[model samples]
Target: MTFAKLRVRAMMVALLLSIFAVGGRGVSAQTNAYATAFTTSITYQNIGTGTANINLTVYSSSGTPSAIPASTLAQNGAGSYFVGSVSGLGTTFNGSAVISADQPIAATLVQIPAAASQVKNRPLSNGFSSGSDVVLIPTVLKSFANYTSKFVIQNTDSVANDFTVQFINPANGAVVHTANPANVLPNTSVYYDAGTIAALTGTFNGSVKVTAVKTGTTNPGSAVGTALELQTNGVGAYASQAFPASAAATKVFMATSLCNLVIPSGATTTFYAVQNAGTASASVTVTYVGTAGSTPVNVTSTATTIAAGAKASFNPCGLAPNGFSGSATINSTQPILAIGKVSGAGLYTAFEGATAGSAKTALPYVRWLAPAQGGQQTFIAIQNVGTTAATNVTVKYYSGSGTLLGTHTIPSIAAGAKASSNPTSASPSAAGMGVGGGSAVVEGTGAQLIVVTRVTSPVTGGTTGEDYNGIPFN
Candidate 1:
């Protein structure tokens, strides 16, 4: 990949880190229930062929910056760092960050709440490489089922800009409310709470679109953002990066979907929200492909229609058999964006669907711990989206210092099929991998693949967890 592409990918990773660094409060200090503190662990893998020297510049919400010590990683290796443990940033610190690397890398950030808070939710998001003038958020809520949504938008350009947020009703093509345009400083972020919007009264579930424009002109400006849905009465939370207009597609793929999959904590199910991004109404269909047995069982959604700027949702809970685990593909007549949420027994996670697959993908966080041990463990689901079956699919695990831990292989994966791996059962297990977290890279020879990873807290009978999309090496 060219230097520009690498930088774009790395920037995406940095965008996510900045989100939590600022506590999603922009220039102000996070407060009250929103003030829940978290320590962050960042995992990054060098996707380039050469060694990488990575540096981070953390910017406080006030725009003051602190330079973090540099770290190095070998080709295809991975490394990690703890943001809260770093010195110099006093307590109550909140801000944005920028990452610079000599070689291409993919990164993810995991936010763990302080023990005192007893918050089990472990929310995560992948880095964003670039920004856009317009962004789409597939799902947003306002006092709906005791849940609400919040978003933080960062201006990626060197100049200040004004952003307009429009909440669109999914049932009809209408703008329920439009928040007053907010002006944000360059390289800084601003937060919006749906609960605070009086126009968005009780029980509202819909989609959101944000547009950034030059401070004094109608010309488009650059920005990136992330949104989170929080359970008002509990600790449940899930996050997803806002989708740029360019990310909308006629088709989208989700690597993993659960339909009443019984786990220690509870039965799991996945629901998807598809937003119509085009000017015209959209005709959509969702196809679920089961991966549980020898033969694949396919289920399709009824003909659904969504008005422009609106969103439609469907779940496999009642459509698929109990204990069903599978993948989903969404087809639409109009360009659309999609996001999936997996929920059950206190576990909540949201991930953006893939508009396209890559030959290789990077997973920045992977963990493993025995069920009885009671800690976080990760389950990875990879889908072969290529025309032909994928063969010689391999995953390489690397330690925080870039040391090769071990490799796991999936001999062959038929096209449109899925495969999975669990670090707890890794072959030729590497020391410390099961107890300590690491990073990994998945490669599918001459085939395209997409990946989604689920991290469950407490190993088994976990009450909270999160999911994130694997970074593709463009």
Candidate 2:
């Protein structure tokens, strides 16, 4: 603690402080140095039947004298296209690597139309044929794990073709997978997986949709293409299934958690909730929203719970009170969740027969068209596009003119048949047709329709066909 020693220490501390102030700023600048950027390009071309070629490359910015070399690139085939990434840059990138592809070089596009056509929706048949820019979905229901769906896209083109498969949750219309699109060649079918797809789309959904866009390529063209849709439904924890209990107290079933039965966007999908292997006392709560059916339907007493090691069947449509629809989440503290669906009717009818009442349900694709001006007439058409017959098909209309016209229910419609009617009277009205004029609107001020269709199928668990049309008034 000498005064001389203290003075020396202060001098050293001041000198070190000055050096830190000078060096700290210089270190910060070096660490914060900016890096150059680059870009990428991809293209696809269909040469002929079942064949497509793809080309993907990366290029650095023209502003830089020496761009990132093309050799520092890696490429992989996705659904119908190819994806590329660069490495060894040693820093985060300002310019992202560009990824592009041609539709021809991508995977095939498949369309699953409403299951109205007997031939199209029938069991075990080539659903539809494919042509240039036309994609057909085979009438097959496949499952994948973790709500991840997988399918094979067949390229019936002549040249090497590429494709891009996108996964979408039809239940809520969400995109799940995007596999950088891909390239298919003559006589080759690309088997796409969830990993590649998730990388491309940056997310995943319950069901997947494969879209084969032609990437950039020379002489890209397509002759025939198609994609498959798949879904695992949901995680096991999100679902519950069991036979009915012996006693009334045991009737209540608990699901591990709330389950979500999702459908992809732009997808025509169906879901079935069945009361399997239970007695008449077996019941469940089904909750859901959308055009599938009436929301918050309860499935009760339709299932027969077996005594001890016995089994029985319960149908939601046969429940005590009917005409209800929706999906249920097992949120009750008592914990009673409906069993997993086992090949039954649509959302509403799924619980019918198990209960006792008129089980009226709505159609998923049913919606209203835009409203018409005075003297203008709107035509709402219901087309039976499913495989099975439809019963009690109904279409309710509303006037955007701030009037409720009531509802109209159709008795039935055969497959491939089109039913069209003017929302209002076929004749024009002075200030537009009055309420109950066959014209109506849904939730908002715009014109809308409430559609309902009961499926009639020879098989116990077959689905009905569907189609829709909206005619706007002048």
Candidate 3:
């Protein structure tokens, strides 16, 4: 071997390393999950004809029972109850809750970041589901610049359990960072701050796979019950179901409304992230339902193919180009799971796909009022996803205390059509209605109507708005 040849090879290796900056700086892989403090708000709506007796249970990160609180709510009509209203939860308390109702009820637990004093922020929302050993987080962003996710995982089991999270890059189907945020004791909740974590500091955007293994076993099959939440940049998203499950459906229905032709500056849109969790690649078709007025309008997206191990994001309004505000249904050639983020007018909600003809779509609680200092307003949007037309459908407005204040009933809604109402203008204040407390419930007979809500603050000058989804009583 010649010394001159060896010198040439060493010089080439050094040149490549310098070009890629592969010498000293390295990306960190986040490992070990820890509990970080966050603000949580729990809201529940009574769907029964009568009042509901609700029981609340709280658990800490170590899987210990936190507290037991009980409250009985009776009002003029349908309304909401914050768990802290009857419990000892502080304004900044962080934990998990389980609400049980004597009568039929619907509820959600929301974790809010420190909201701007004069503006609104996106809050992570989740509707409680039963025991599961695994959770699939469809979307996450950390290396995307000013985009990071605060992820929460809680145990629903009564006994201690072990948990692990694998952050994967969707583009290449590679596990980017693996972290064990500590084991979960029974009934406890844990949090992970991706922005501050050293292991997850490297730039990457994709999905999360969370598994809760049994406390004493290393088997992946020994998963206990678990729940999850993820939030970033004033927007939140949640997994509707945890386990590796699939629906054998060809179509999925989503109720939507209002796509501003010129999207506002810093305006995040309503979008769906379709993840093909299956092994074989799949193809999907997306179609929108426009409002039926003096003129009929419709919009659709080109058929898309999602790789077997990857996912895609879609903004329906941007698919073709239309200002139509209404409903949408996605059809696929193979099985798929969809996680939707609906945002416009400063509000966002994590949406779970539903089957067609499945609603008495009602947003159990909404707020609208004009006060001297500030104001609160609400927009209720319902989309009829059924084949049959929805007729004589009504959005019944009520005071937060349960008194029916006013009503706005539309004459008819065609199949795939949507109807929206602003209670502040359309429905005047009625009996016992206060200034800031507002509530609403939807009713109709034939086809199911999908309902989603938008609530804004400072009612008059404030720019903050938050979106809440309606309860579809099965």
Candidate 4:
């Protein structure tokens, strides 16, 4: 398997189509502070088939960007907004880059801000509204040992920007380093600290892509937007938790290749096994037992086939199943959400706290959008009310009074899929409460998941937010 591992498995189907595109925005007020630096002037007119009308104007770099007149700013069908939601301008900006497939295209942009601006200044942003197949990787990574690790890349755009680092070598895709236009100044995030670049002594597994470009676009729009090579061997997880199945398959939930997750052996020692593929092709197998359920020797395998509402993963290394004695049986019919990634050999550990009322029901985490650290961070809105797809789901955060703060795990979501997360690094203290307080029941033997929680209170004027349909809240 080479060709960059078959283009990293065909780029995981465009990373599940940008997580089934609804638009992302999570993590509010974490406070890294890169304030005051406006002068955003965007203009792109293509207006026809796949469409493109975009027009933006923001000054303050010195002011006079024409005094700020893009027709007062507020057009609808192509792209024009003074503010609608770019969420705190910390950056999430996504893309699809199409401009001519038939009509109605719009990778992103929906403004309205100017009422003195304050959802952290409101500039709002979106470039591939659904067009520009944005993929630009300008690498420079360097860490095979001194290890401190952070190098993240997920600015699914809603303001705050800066992500340009390319280094491709998924084993022969080769590119090495080619992302030199760095400036994620808007939404706020860009990472560094593997000692500071330059290490990997030998065998080299290569893979590095940290893209989010739209500062002056000279064209970095397709070929899946190239750049994804930063592999040491790959596989690093711990942000998946969701287990709830027994309400007689919650209403109507399809997706059953087989499902199981018992793990009842004297309580915590080592546990993690998640496999979700809610039906389309069906392929499942996972087992581990000790408390009398029997089946031990420990195993791991991850085939694939869950198109109804896709998600897949099978992990086992801690050991305790060659014959078994207590409990852990997951036969299959579709439904497996287990979590306990906790290992940080290369690094990325944080979040292993909330179970608060844990009776046990799948809880997944790994859906992020960062850059807020003031309100104390607390947002949860994993809405996919269930008609079919709700694979590996888990979203837990609190503040309004319940106060939990941390937990996110998402793998599959399609049916009605809505997204939002704030596993708290900081910024939200709490808002209206309701979302079942902090929400995280998500069951699936057959199915169940329809979470909600929107808290944003770092004070200032204290109110929080919500958007609906297109999905947005902080």
The alpha-carbon lDDT assigned to residue 453 of candidate 3 equals 70
Per-model C-alpha RMSD: 4.5, 26.5, 14.7, 22.4
Question: For candidate 1, what is the lDDT?
Answer: 0.76
Give the per-residue lDDT digits (tens) of candidate 3, residues 1-474: 221110000000000111112223322321211122223445555556666666666654444443445676554344333333333333334455566666666554433332222213424243443555666666666645335555556666656667778877666556778887555665556665566666656765677777777677864422222222334332333323333433334677777633553334234456786766666767887787564333455667888887664567777666434455556788877666666665544444566565555446546446555565345556777778777898888777766556677878788988777777767434554423455354567778765877767655542232445555676655
Question: In candidate 2, what are the lDDT values of residues 1-474, reduced to their tens digit?
Answer: 221110000000000111122332211111100110111111111211222222232222111111222221112111211111233322221111121222122111112111221122111001111224323221112223323222344443445555654443423333444554355543334444343442434443333323443545644344222222222331111111111111112222211111233322112222332222222333333322222233443333323232211112223343322333232221122212122232212221111111100112111111232233212123343444333445655444323222334455555654323344444332232123332222231121111222222211122243322221121111
| lDDT, residue 458, model 3 | 42
Q: What would the per-residue lDDT of candidate 1 be over residues 224-311, giving only the tens digit for each residue?
A: 8777777776677777888999899999998888888887788888989899999998999888888444456689888799999999
TM-score of each: 0.89, 0.25, 0.75, 0.22
Top of the candidates by lDDT: 1
lDDT of each: 0.76, 0.26, 0.54, 0.28
Model 4: residues >4 Å from true position, as ranges? Answer: 1-164, 172-177, 183-294, 297-399, 403-436, 439-474
Q: Tens digits of per-residue lDDT for model 4 on 70-186?
A: 222111121222222223222322221122222232232112112222323211122323212233221222433221222323232333343455454532344444545453333
Q: What C-alpha lDDT, on a 0 to 100 scale, does residue 355 get in candidate 4?
A: 15
Which candidate's TM-score is highest? 1
Better of 2 and 4 by lDDT: 4
How far out, in Å, is residue 397 in model 3?
2.8
